[model samples]
Target: MYFVKKSIVIVIGSILISLGINLFLVPYKVLDGGIIGIGLILNYLWGLKAGLTIIVLSIPIFIIAWVSYRDYFYNSLHGMIISSLFIDFLKTNDSLFLINPVYSSILGGVLVGSGIGLMLRFRTSTGGTDLIAQFLCDKTGINVGILIFFIDSFVILLGGILLSTDTLFLSVITIMFVALTTSLFTRNVVQA
Candidate 1:
């Protein structure tokens, strides 16, 4: 029962993440942080596949997880792979909702954040920088959400520098929503 529940959560979470990216973020070229942000950057710059890029970029992070946190490696590897596959398979050219970019960004962030948060609650995650954040959380006694926020903000800054002023502004908003939603979801749960 526990394994089934975890699998369901992972699938739902992966779907939400993929939908948010394809339906909202990709349309406006807005970004979420961490590996997703890097994936988006590469997608924008070179038409690379974001899912594939995420997998490729995650290699070193997974190695770290394998070495230091064996449980995390097992917990998150499937979520990460599933989410990446979902992302590559589901493609959308433009915003399906026809909302303005600001609203679009907010919704996108919410969905993505919710997905990430849901899996996290189950002790499974879409490993990327998330793996690093978890490791740090275990080491420093700091809240994982705050660590995610800082890492996300750094990525947003990178996106801003590499992309456009508009992208910078929108990405900042996106990451804020992502952080808030993620924190809310994880508020009462003891980190796993």
Candidate 2:
């Protein structure tokens, strides 16, 4: 039933997002946004595990959701845990295929965005900053997509300062792709 469908979607979405990170973004030092970006920054700067970093960074947000947004907490908890674990586990795998950094960024964005959109469609997501964005969206009536893009851009800018101009440029392209794809994929879904 609905639970089974949601589970399957979450699993598939998590795998796709993990593949995008492990096979494309990580190799090139490109970043997505939100907790994932933070995780990547930690990995780049300290050799920390990106997934573990995501989990750690997400703790405060999850705690907030648990207290004030129980439905969101219930919906997103498994998605967050599964996706984070998959991302960490899949990091050991070799890249699926070699390609230019630009192409990798685009493909990574698409994969990650599609995964996120799919989960959102099912009323679930990988949590983290996404939950914050959702809460803001509910209160402000702004498009969640736009909020996510702005948040992502801020992260990428911070990353640019810490990483490289190339990282920033490529990440901008990646986030744009993610925004477009997520919007398209979630057109009929409830707003996140």
Candidate 3:
């Protein structure tokens, strides 16, 4: 029963993430943190696909997890692969959401946050920011969420400096939404 429930959650979570990427973030040109954010920034600079970049970037993070944290690697591998595939596949459907640029940031934030929360609830992660967060937590005994925020915050700030003001503001809003939605979704999840 637990396995079934977890599988369902992963599916739904991945859908939310893909929706956030294709419908909200990608269309509006908003950025988040982690590998995805970097991918978006690169896309802005180099005209690359953010989804494909995320998948490729995740390879190194996965390699690190596999070598340094076998348990985390085992747990997050499926989610990382599925979410990456879904994000890339859903690009063709970008017009479905029909949201404005600002709304896109908010919606994307909520979706991404909730997705990550659900994955974390199941003891899984998408293995971009989470991998780094886990490494920090393991090494420093600080909360993973806080560490994630700190790291992402730096990226967002850099994005602000490098990009437009709108992108910077949207990134902040998106991160806030991600944090809120993740907390709301995983409020009752137990950590093992």
Candidate 4:
């Protein structure tokens, strides 16, 4: 039962993440933090696959997780791989589902946030910078959400510097949604 429940949650969360990326964030060339943000920036610069980029970029973070928080590493590794693969494989096939930037941002936030929350509730994560945030939270006594916000903001800034102003603006919006949604989703877990 536990396995089934966890799998279902992972599936739903992965789908929401993919939708958030494909339907809204990627279309606008926005960036989020962690491996996802790196993937977006790379995608913008070299027209690479975001999912592949995410997987490739996650290596170092995963190594960090392995060294610092083995339990977190165990829980999140699968979520990260599945989510990245689905986001890359599913979203790349089409571009017919675009929506308004504001609405997309909101929806993306809600879905991604809820998905992340669910995963966190199960003692797992989306597995990118999340592990780093957890590591920082454990070591520094800072809130994970705050750590995530700071890290993501840096990534957004990087996007701004490397890309056009329009991409920078979009990246800001994307980071906003990611921050809002992630916070909302993790409210219960973080509180606990």
Candidate 5:
């Protein structure tokens, strides 16, 4: 029963995340944090598929998780695969609605953050840096939320340097919302 519930949550979360990226962030070229951010960068710079890029970039992290954090690997593998596929599939769809870039950033952040938080609450995640964050949190006794925020900020900074200042600012706003919403939802849930 627990397994079934978790699976359902993960699928729903993945769908929400895919919708956020495709309908809001991708249209504005706004980036999310972690592997998604890297994927977005690849998409903007080289016209690569963001979902494919996410899977490719996450390989090393997943490898690390498999070796050192077997439980996390098991928990997150499905989430990663499902979410990546959904992201790629949804990217091809037309935008659900058009809005200002700022509004898009906020809305995208909310959707992505809520999806991520819900999965995290269920002891699952989209993997990638999230796995690393969980591992580090376990080892260092740091709050996962804070660690995630730091990692996200670093990625956003890199995006700023590699992309544009406008992207930086907008992405910062998006990530702030992501971090806040994620923290709110994951507050009472189990830590990875």
Candidate 6:
């Protein structure tokens, strides 16, 4: 039963994240944070597939997780791979969610936040820098959410410089929504 529930969470979470990225974020050249943000930067810069970049970028993080947090390694590998694949698979569907960039940022943030939040609830996540944040949280006893926000902010700053000023500003909105929505989903739930 536990396995089944986690599998379901991964699938739904991956889909929501993919839709949010390909449909909402991609169209506006906006970005999420962490590895996904990096992936978007690559995509915007070179037409690279975001999912592939995420998978490739996540390798080192997963290796670290394997060395220290065995459970996180085993659990998040599937989430990372599936979400990355879903991001690429859904790339062809980009025009599906066209809207005002601000609206896109809010809705995209909510979708991604919900996906990530659900996975985190199940003790699985899309890994990448999220895994790094988790590792930092464990070692430093910092709040995982705060760490994630910081990582995300750095990514947004880099993206704004690489992409455009508008990307930086809109991405701030997206991250705020993502963080808020993630908080809502994980509210009262014990962190794993």
Q: Which candidate number would show the highest TM-score if scored against the true structure?
A: 1
Q: Please, what is the whole-model Cα lDDT of each candidate in the order they appear?
A: 0.89, 0.87, 0.79, 0.76, 0.87, 0.89
Q: How many residue pairs clash in each candidate?
A: 0, 0, 0, 0, 0, 0
Query: In model 6, where is the ten-residue run with the lowest total lDDT?
Result: 183-192
Residue-level lDDT tens digits of model 6 in 1-192 = 999999999999999999888888988899899999999999999999999999999999988888988989998999999999999988874387678999999999999988988887887889998788777766886666667778999999999999999999989999988888876776656554
| lDDT of predicted model 6 | 0.89
- Clashes in model 5: which pairs? none
Ten contiguous residues with the weakest lDDT in model 4: 183-192
Strongest candidate by lDDT: 1
In the range 15-118, model 3's lDDT, one tens digit per residue, is 89888877788776688888878877887778887777888988888888888888899888888778877877777633777767788899999888888888
Candidates ranked by lDDT: 1, 6, 2, 5, 3, 4
Q: Listing every candidate in turn, what is its Cα RMSD in Å to the true structure after a full C-alpha superposition?
A: 1.0, 1.4, 2.2, 2.0, 1.4, 1.3
Q: Write the per-residue lDDT of candidate 1 for residues 72-134, one digit (tens) a residue.
A: 999999999999999999977755787899988999889998998899889889999877887
List where candidate 6 sits over 4 angstroms from the true fold: none
TM-score of model number 6: 0.95
lDDT of candidate model 4 versus the reference? 0.76
| Candidate 1 vs candidate 4, TM-score winner | 1
lDDT over C-alpha atoms for residue 157 of model 4: 86
Worst 10 residues of 3 by lDDT: 183-192
The clash number for model 1 is: 0
TM-score of every prediction relative to native: 0.97, 0.95, 0.87, 0.89, 0.95, 0.95
Error of 2 at 147 (Å): 1.4
